[model samples]
Target: MNRKRSRGKNPWRCSHRYPLRRRRRATPGRSRGDPAVDPEDPEQDPDDGNAPPSDDDEDDDEAGPVVTTTHRRFDYPPPVPRMPRETLEMLHYDQFWITYVGTRYRHPALPDDWDMTVEISIPDEFGSRQNIHVRHAPTRRNSHEAAISDAAREALTTLCHAHREDMAITSRRYYPCRSVERLDAWIANPEAEQNPRLESTIEYLATLNTDYNAALDELDMVRYENRKLRAWVAHGVEPAEEEPVEDPADAPRRKKARYNDPEARTYIRHHED
Candidate 1:
């Protein structure tokens, strides 16, 4: 026998009416928690400066920089060395002593040649420096002597300007040299001795130092005497105070002068004082 279908309402009424289609995802085939994008909304580039930074970008900024250095030990090359140093000249002018030292060194840029550098050392014993390394100047040519002279002039000029700016000469009873021409003339002359004023000042300083040392020695002797006196007093060894002279009337009478009368009589002589 053949079964007939129900006619009131079919149980599979809309099952096969339309073909099934897979809905396309915003990030094609990705069904993550990110909301569907609106096609009508303007596109935003994350690299744009006006756009707000993402949480991941902020976290990356907060993290410290990653170090990519190697841990292996490496033997580095030694530093370039300076050749033998020679004293170019020494002179005194305006209470200042200038010492120029010539130095030879191989520059990395000119490896085949040795270059000369002049160092100007001014002994400003009374100033802010003991032995001041004033300037280190390199020569354009191969003339060390001329270079030294030029360095000296330039160094003096610089020092003069510095003094003008801040009075950098902090030594007592001192001043900067303002005249380089006169100094050069003096240097050129063979018979030119040290500055007379500088000599006199130095002589006076030496005398003062000697006097100071003598005074200190005297003070030390005085202190030693004071300490010795204190120790003697503490030990009850100090000298006794001198007693005052007694009056003749209060003193006991002697027995010899009265008995000296011609017959050698034994009589006591009374003191009338």
Candidate 2:
């Protein structure tokens, strides 16, 4: 049935307006039945307006205490090392005796110009063992004479060292307490000029110095000859020979002719003819 339209409004407009008003429920985020936020409520989050309240503490309790399985470590000491079986043992002796066992030259034919091997026997080893040392030119290539000098010098050095204490005692005996205020200062006094001990030491040292000087001179000659020979050998040069000595009897003698001689007279007559 057709109803009478309102006087001021259109019929279509009135009908659409009433239905829209009744169909529009609450606005999207807010509804009439939704719970209101209490300002004092502890469980509610002031910042989280959209999310619901949660029971975080109850959930953590339900998960219980965390259990972790760890790996066990085993520690043992390092293996002990064993000593080598092939190691040699050192020979130990309380005392050792040394004895001269003669010298051996490097070259038998040219012994004077060669090195010498001095062998010393170890008496503790029952003379079966010997220590051989090469005695040669100390500074440069010299002669066997220098080698002998070196051996003598070494022997004297050893002898002096061995008898050092004895020599000191002997010196003290010569310069007694009455000699000076102190034994060391005895040589500083003028009276010590006549000291027998000082004289003997001076004489001994002078003799050694003289011998050493002689050896040095000999060694110098040997060194010069050796160097010359080596240089000549390097250049492939033969050594020069000594000149032969002239004999007075081998010279041709001329006899002086006298005017009275027959040969001279015949020569003069031949020339005249």
Candidate 3:
């Protein structure tokens, strides 16, 4: 017997006649979790800056940059005060003393190539006087003058080292030596035979150096005031009134002398027969 079909509604619907919607597949380079895009979408462009990020880009954003922090400490030394150019130039050369003992002995057969020794006095880089001893094995062309010249040259080279600025010589004094014997004797007994002229020069240079450093400190104070004034103007505030400077005489005084009388000869020279 043939079964009769229901006329009100079909019990089983054909899948081809009413198909359910299926999810779209991702393209080859598309990442998971990214919204599926329609190839036919007019806004979608593979080469556009707005293109979806790949798997690597997403992973990088999830993992933030790896930073390395280091802590270090450094210690710096205080700055050295620079000497003015004029000062260096004026102090570059100094007086030297050379004594040929053989000349006083009336030795006519003294060889020109005899050993030579000289005393060199010049201002050091710090503007302090320094006395140096120089000895040279004389050649056939070397004389007393040549020996003195060589010593002076070496002393001058030391004074002008690392100098590239300008400074003026406020004052300089040159004293003539009357007698070497007297000088040597004075060296032996400074209390009895003091060189007043040289002592005065040393005192003057010490005073000058002290004055220069004090002037620098004053300049720093002035600059600090200027900076404060500028900051006050920027902030639209009235600056505080400065106190009157005290008289220099009223300031506390301390005798800070850097001068120590240097010996004429640091060590005695011994001659061998």
Candidate 4:
């Protein structure tokens, strides 16, 4: 038999007197032996009544190192490179030197009018450079590039034909006569305008020509002179002295001609007698 219900102030016996609530358990974060923090204390947080005291060093050791990131725009593109308004460069010591010119770095100083995109310089024996000014007009197709190309084509065609005789005498090891003849044929036929291959050929042929070649020639000449000087020094060779000419006025006067004067001739004859 169940024990008689004891009418005491126990929630188990008298369910109506007490409101239902979850029972509090021992907190894992704190032990029963630990001292409870006073809410009125300044150092302790009022809301965190059950928080346990932790060591600063232990917390720091468990935490990872602090990392600061400095962001950059590697994905973002950079600004366009600066180009020259005008460039003075030498063209063509070799064949197709005209093709060295390109449409890049073109400065449209006058976007609306004509522009001298670039100039070519050819150095002479006197250390003076002859400049060929190339002018072009911007068009609907590609602005100044095509015009510059056409201008170059016109000038280079003329120069090539004029220098054909010069080219025959020089050793054109890379650029053969057949290639020039073919190019000449294309230019003469006016079919080069329709053919992109001709333009490409111009570019291809242009690879062999550069200002460096001219510089190399000059460098070779300097080295040759230096070699001669070094050879002379090593051999102790001295230049031969030129013979000094005798002054005509310093020479003794020739003896008077006896034939020129009758008195001199008679004097000579008497002396003989």
Which residues of candidate 3, in runs, are more than 4 Å off?
1-194, 236-273
Candidate 3: worst 10 consecutive residues by lDDT? Answer: 67-76
Task: Please name the candidate that would achieve the greatest TM-score relative to the true structure.
Answer: 2
Clashing pairs in 3: 84-166, 84-167, 85-165, 85-166, 85-167, 86-166, 86-167, 87-167
Worst 10 residues of 1 by lDDT: 67-76
- The sequence of per-residue lDDT tens digits that candidate 2 reaches over residues 34-115 is 2233234789754433221122211211111111111100110111000000000011222222221112212111222332
Deviating ranges (above 4 Å) for candidate 2: 1-111, 125-150, 166-204, 207-225, 228-273
Q: Model 4 over residues 1-273: C-alpha lDDT tens digits? A: 875432332212211211112222455875432323432368975334322112221221111111111111101121210011111111235311111122221111112111212233344568544444232211111223343443343333333344445433333211312121121211122132577776455444433322222333344355445434533543434322223424321112112222233221111001100
Tell me model 3's lDDT, rounded to 2 decimals: 0.28
Question: Lowest lDDT 10-mer window, candidate 2?
Answer: 80-89
C-alpha local distance difference test of each model: 0.28, 0.27, 0.28, 0.27
Question: In order, what is each prediction's RMSD in angstroms?
Answer: 45.4, 55.9, 39.1, 45.6
Cα deviation of 234, candidate 3, in Å: 2.0
Q: What TM-score would each prediction reach against the true structure?
A: 0.20, 0.28, 0.20, 0.21
Per-residue C-alpha lDDT of model 1 across residues 1-273, encoded as one tens digit per residue: 854443443322221111111222234653322212322246943222222122232221111111111110011121111110111121222332233333221111121111122233233546432333244332222333443443443354334433333322223112222222221101111113358776555455444433432343354355445434643544424323324424321111111111123322211112211
16, model 2: CA deviation in Å?
A: 99
User: What does the lDDT read for residue 157 in candidate 4?
Assistant: 34
